[model samples]
Target: MKKIIYTMILAAGVFSTTACVDELDQTPHTEITSGDVYTSAANYKSVLAKVYASYVIAGQEKGGGNKDIATTSGYDYMRCYFNMQECGTDEMASTWLEGDKVKDISYLTWDASDPWVSDTYYLIYQTIDYANEFLRNATDDNISKFSDSDRALIKQYRAEARFLRALSYYHAMDLYRNIPFVTEKDEVGSFTPPRYTSSQIFDYIESELKDIDGDLLDRSEAEYGRATKGAAWTLLAKMYLNAEIYTGKARYSDCITYCNKVIGDGYSLEGDYSKLFNADNQKRTNEIIFPLSVDATHTVSWGATTYIVCGEVDGNSSENPLTYGVKSAWSMFRLRGELTSLFASGDKRAMFYTKGQSQYLDTGIDTQTNGYLMTKYRNLLDNDSVASNTASYGASIDFPMFRLADVYLMYAESVVRGGDGGSIGTALGYINKLRERAYGSTDGDVKTTDLTKNFILDERARELYMEGTRRTDLIRYGKFTTSDYLWQWKGGVKDGKAVNSKYNYYPIPQTELTANPNLHNDNY
Candidate 1:
């Protein structure tokens, strides 16, 4: 599969050389067009491959030359999204001080000009534009040059492109609430699409997913790092789980409906919780429904798991960098005290290093030893091996975006939230499966009477920490901005403080508002 992704890299270079243009310009560059590139079935698949590559590759060419979005840095999509989603919450924090506006995220003092906020906005739309460009060019009339089997393959490509577009729109709807909506139907010259309310975007995403559900490959057939019926079901379950937050309407029954679809799809929990984050997680496809594939050799980048694995190390630790499959340590990201406390004495999920670090953070001296180090995500393989080509800037570990365990947690939460058509017993069974895995036995299993909304929140933290989900989970639980749930160093204080509720949704980037008059920052 790495060979295939490398082929797509060459394809991406050809596609971008011909049809790429500045996203903010709103007009296609007259230099070259899609007609010059979409000449055959292989070319059409290449173009579709570039749409998926947009999430993994940060630029036109690999290793930081021609970036998709130009911000303070190259601003890779996953790295920026992880910073925005995890840094400001109880799960993680950074120690780097030079040019680090990430502290603003931890402090809840961000405005529209924050580079991460703007980069996330740009990255989502950039990926959407790529998908739309593919959809517009890969029409049935345009693809008549191919055979019937080739045409059928192109149909699946079109559905995958639509699914990718909906995924980006789902992120936009989650983060920015009201966003400027565009699609393949929209003209590409000097146009500014009007803003759609959160509910409208929600409805659009749901309809788009349903329209493409049957066209997508099943879980068993989906290639590595590609969308499938399970991916669509998991995403729909997530959106429906947060329906109350997005549309002011409770839809937990709908959440349970999609969750059950995924749960019944033959996906089961991985026996060893830690093996799912190792370098060879590609083999753990039984549990991981969707993943962002990374490689030390072929798919090398400063983003992806390279950023995650190196960021959590200490500068002076006795641990071997080669053990984690990196050349050097970054000594940056660490856990807050609130996170380590969520685990019990013998929970196997409590994979934290507390040798020289304090559980309680001292904000006055925010050093590497201020908080416990999280060892959840490592660069070793399942057999305790590192990649042969491991370097300081790349890792082979793949990041799981959606897995079956998360679906189990979502199902339990929906049932506890008063969603109908779901049994509490089934929800309890789902949760105890995760617990049994974490504890390596049934000793940590919870009784049916122990199920509650609060218990699910803490259980999610214990199960899914450092996987780029804590901030959104906290927001959904109504504990993100309020002082009701405070963590060490939150809002830049030793004892956490409440921040303005406007931080709930990041402000629409001021550059976007200045560029398009049709868009406004109504929520903030």
Candidate 2:
């Protein structure tokens, strides 16, 4: 077999000696080599599979770095399908509490913090590198092994890689406003590249998505949870929706345009909202796009399994059957009181969480109690086997990175911003569909047009809570630090929740600041 050379030329001089000359004239250490692992196609597939594997919960215990990542699920952060018990006053880390407990101190470095933050940044890039290399070096012989359909599938994987790279940049920009945006494999390990402005970062994401948007399949193939055109459009709409925040430029009209494409592209609300997160319902109905792909047995190996808590000797356990303890001390972030009250008195989603529920169940922990259990990701214990049951993955569940409901909410917000009739109708149409599904039918009061940033904020809260976009939504919509009576964070909330410009951007990590003196803090 001929050796295939996959070299990605990057303009950023990532591995170039000129950039590193001043520090040391020594040869740089190469992290990856053409060992048997990197050379073969099957291994390349597995490498990409592992790249997607990061989406799984890595740290389940309190001491490990898992707690930090899971923290994104807690009240101080995202809070999609909220667990109220987790937000009670008893838990000091709850975002509802005042002082530094849920403060925006996440990115602040204290001398020797675990390198998880840096590791996350680096790992994502490494995944991108492997993807780029595989796609670039793949030969006719390499692709010939698979049928034509499989070859196209491999290309879809390449587009998926681009989508993941863009997603990483999107999230990185959300957490670290000043980050170096690199496109190719060669850009790995280069620190001197100037951090792009938030606007530049968004531009990079938009451009990258646009470049690969044509390559994505119109509909996803079986077992292919990779990005689709609809997913790209939805992500683009989300990026444009925040144009005012990220770039200080209003792109609400653009947001509405892309959201319409997402809606018109044949994706709609799945009949039941619960199915969207049910372990048995992997690839269930409403998904416009999601990160985790379900297998033949309906088990999703890479989904958020860390949410499971083991059954305790005292007859207490989490709602999930997996019985894995709160893998990380990180708990689910519960809905704000405002958001919790938005649902109609009998809304089914209201039951998605066990608010004020005790944590002693199933979880081995006895002393720790208070806060809601996240029932959205929770599974029933001791479900029937896959062969015996319609949906039985035994213990795995897939995670949704994007869904149709989000498209509707984003369209509504864009309409409110654009102040156009088409925008209003487009927004309401999407919202009403979701309303009809969530309520089983559009009862007169099920859908409302009182579309406004605040209303959509509430709708987003009701729809997307605990799905990982809450904190970013809160920040972009000027709700993250609002101290006013309307959607305000209030002083009683985390970090003097008064609306401040500084709260819009997270602080630069102290470690990064020390490494690159040129870096400036968000406050500064």
Candidate 3:
């Protein structure tokens, strides 16, 4: 099926996708004023699609000529967040020299001035700003002009806007701890957003998710890219799973509750695990609960799956770009050596190209040979076909924001932590289901005796590495900044020494602090 995303190019009045072409595509609208943009029912959905697309593409252009963030187009929301989650963790490393912020993150020596640090902070708010703008116009008066059917759809869309806002604030709260926040309720002017305590932000996220519970579409009914009840539940489960870190209380039972809710939704594991990350993954709706849609021919950005697939290829090596469905090889990133030890033979989770890489990395990861490259997130289709996507023209592989396999893993982790409302037997069944697919048999199944915290963490590493969950997982287990688990060059030390706990949460970017006197980061 051909993907459909409405393009609305508004310099100041809207947030939108940069590209959409051909039939079923409406002519791109421009300079939509805030008051008149919501005059029609179709425009409401079109702008809502913009809120979703803004995260993937940079701005209202085919590719990179215009961008939301002037410093770097690649620092769009998901890419910046991906850098925060994967680079410094044991899961990944960079081949670039130590002159850039990407390298700064790989070494965990990032300061507030780091481009990624600032971009992650800003792009998240940009997303929230767009969501708030949508919510602001989605009032009862605005929709009262439309038909009853359109009114109903707008109500659902309003709730989805709130879900997207909560999603952005969730990232902000996790990475920055305490920061200023804004909402549709606040005045949209040049005033500073008031700083909320981390707990206040946590409560706000929880409240928003709960409030939208009845308003969101059921998992099976919503469009593939839109937020659904399952997506909100998954976010709640993930947030609750880390409740102690966020709010000083263990909410594992709550995590279990939401995970169970998602489990009961009409999602199931994709029979082939690798197919979940392939270019044709949009058709694999069996597992992808919420997706960031990308079109090889239309939506184009040097981010998301394109960033992952292209960067994994070494142009110097015989790694053909066409095999990965991209036009170029960046030769930038590979799996860190520590992750290499996690997989044993026959574990299909080990998607490494190890022929030319060292089994272990040396002190510096400044060369292509430092660690084994990952062949996991490819642009190859489920049928082994490649899309003709250029480096600027994004790949067709949609990024899964939430999936059933992750929900299953969250449920099992909650149960292992002695959370009530979950059954260990059921959790074990879920683990075996994942293991069956990973090993192509039941050979990798674990017994109840193996259901320790460490086992669960390692299992998550094998199942979800490089998909942007590593840093958070390591922090929850007290291994991210502690001496408990060490990877090479952690803390900028050759042998990986313990770093200050302040490194756990990034500093409030220097730019943010200079702009808002009301803001401060105690951890920094």
What are the C-alpha RMSDs, in order, of all predicted structures?
Answer: 2.7, 8.4, 4.5
lDDT of model number 3: 0.81
Error of 2 at 519 (Å): 3.1
lDDT of 2 at 147: 66
Better of 2 and 3 by TM-score: 3
Instruction: For residues 1-524, write the lDDT of model 1, one tens digit per residue.
Output: 34233345233323331112244332232444566777777777777777776766677555544665555367567887788888889888688744566767778888888878887888878778878878887888888888998888888888989998998898888888898898877777556678899999999999999999888999787677778999999999999998988899989999999999998899988889999998888888889998887875556677777888877777676656665667777886888888888899779999887887888677532577877887877888777866634453477888899999999999999999999879999999999999999988889999988999899999999989988778789889999999889877677788888888878888778887887777888645
For residue 7, model 3's alpha carbon misses the true position, in angstroms, by: 3.3
lDDT of 1: 0.79
- Candidate structures ordered by lDDT, highest first: 3, 1, 2
Which residue pairs does candidate 1 place in steric collision? none
lDDT of 3 by residue, 1-524 (tens): 43646455353565431111111112334555667678777788878887887777766676644566565534457777888999899988877745445877887877887888877877787778788888888999778888999999999989998998898899999898887878877775555678897789999999999999999999667776778898999999999999999899999999999998988877889998888888888888888888888776656767767777888888877677787877899887888878888887789989888877786678477667778888887888767877646565677778887888889889999999999999999999999999999999988998998888899899999999988899989999999999998888898877898888988888877866776788887756
Highest lDDT: give the candidate number.
3
Candidate 3 Cα errors over 4 Å, as ranges: 1-6, 9-11, 15-31, 71-74
